[model samples]
Target: MRPLQAKIIADLHVQPVIDPESEIRRSVDFLKHYLQHNPQYRSYVIAISGGQDSTLAGKLAKIAITELNAHHTLNYQLIAVRQPYGEQIDAVDATAALDFIQPDQTVTTNIKSSTDAMTLALRDSGLIVNDLSRGSIKPKMRMIAQYAVAREYDGIVIGTDHAAEAFAGFFTKYGDGGTDINPLWRLNKRQGRDMLRTLEAPKTLYEKIPTADLEDDHPQLPDEMALGVSYDYIDDYLEGKNVPNKASEKIEQLYLTSAHKRHEPVTIYDTWFY
Candidate 1:
């Protein structure tokens, strides 16, 4: 490996910077401190899609709320939300996740109506809507539902974006990637599984293949197939290992293109006017 590539890989490795137990404690503490300091935010809201990342984050949030309630006179809670576009094929996994997380409250919101309405409006405006664009609506609509619930309940949306996804920029901007707090932001996918194991998360969560459920016609497509790279490769690359050249190049391309998603919108200031 070249020196620059080796340095980038080393920089992305997470295990050197994370201890599962300590990370869990820090996440819990961070949640408690955030809620305590922010008087308006009364709860943590998580959009649970039955994925391991969301499941793990929701479980940790629940634990934090429980710990906070025991020590303080706070009524903080964790709200696990399920936003399916229609009848989700993986609804069973979502149900299982709910059972495991055991959130303080649950909300089911079907996003089909909202997405369909928006698509129709866009079509009426003389725009062509393709399958990929339609699929992208799911996460955006899910985020909308989550924020609506957060507003109603005075809660902050919790996100599951971690180092694995961040390294490849594998998340939707202003969608699943949008959240008020990201407790798992620093952990890689493998580290996330380690945390799940430490937290005693369900075996199903750690064992299931990750998917975005974007293919409406075929809902079972694995995320690796969609991204054209397996998470194992991504994780390995992020852990400072020598990955295949193709995988490394693809990762770099994704990271570069999605850089905009990871940052706030750029705007030029009116210096002369000021």
Candidate 2:
């Protein structure tokens, strides 16, 4: 490791940004306060992918909803929606996540039809769609499905995006990354696992490898394999650790190239008024 990178790593690790117990309290309070301030939103909607991030966020939202219901006259619901492109091979994990979250309502929305329709439309328009392009549709469709449920229930969609994945831009833009509220925005993958343990999340959820499950041809591909870098290195880099040169360069490239995913849509101004 270079001296500068090593020094940065040492500094970052010396003072951690996340504390499990405090983060839990702050997150739960943030959810409650956010809903209270935004009266129109009566529920919280989350896409439960049976991954550690989602499970942790969903469980935190559930706790906030329950606490709000107890002290306030307003009734808040935590709606966990399972969106599968087709038949989910890891259906058991999703089921287990729901069991642990115990959301107020559960909805299953299959996005295969919608994705197919979009692909067909594009094909009819004389565009040759490839596997990678086609696979990107799944996360966008999932976001659409989640918003549909949230709209119906007067809820805001909750996101599980965190520092580790955000560093690599390891999410579909305006897709799984699209959400109204993100309670787990600052936690890294390691910190997320710690939070899950603190919340007493099911062991299966924390133990399982993270995957986007978006590829139709290679559905079982893990996130690390897809990204060409492992979470350990990602987390270390995120914490300002000195990772190998190859890993560091790849991480920097991903973060730089995918910067657009972190921002809102860009639009040309029609006119400037003085």
The prediction achieving the highest lDDT against the true structure is 2
| TM-scores of all candidate predictions against the true structure | 0.92, 0.91
Q: After superposition, how far is residue 2 of candidate 1 from its true place, in Å?
A: 4.7
Pairs in clash, predicted candidate 2: none
- Cα lDDT tens digits for candidate 2, 201-250: 88999989988877777887899999999998878776766789999888
Q: Could you tell me the TM-score of candidate 2? A: 0.91
Model 2 CA lDDT for position 32: 93
**lDDT of candidate model 2 versus the reference:** 0.84
Query: In each prediction, how many residue pairs overlap at the backbone (N, C-alpha, C within less than 3 A)?
Result: 0, 0
Model 1 lDDT tens row, 1-274: 5454555455444553467898889888988889989987889999998889999899889999999899887688899999988898878889989998999999998999999998899899998977778788878999999999999999999999887787666788888888899988768788888888898888888889998887567677888887788888877777677889998888777766666676676667523222
TM-score of predicted structure 1: 0.92
State each model's CA lDDT, in order. 0.83, 0.84
Top TM-score model: 1
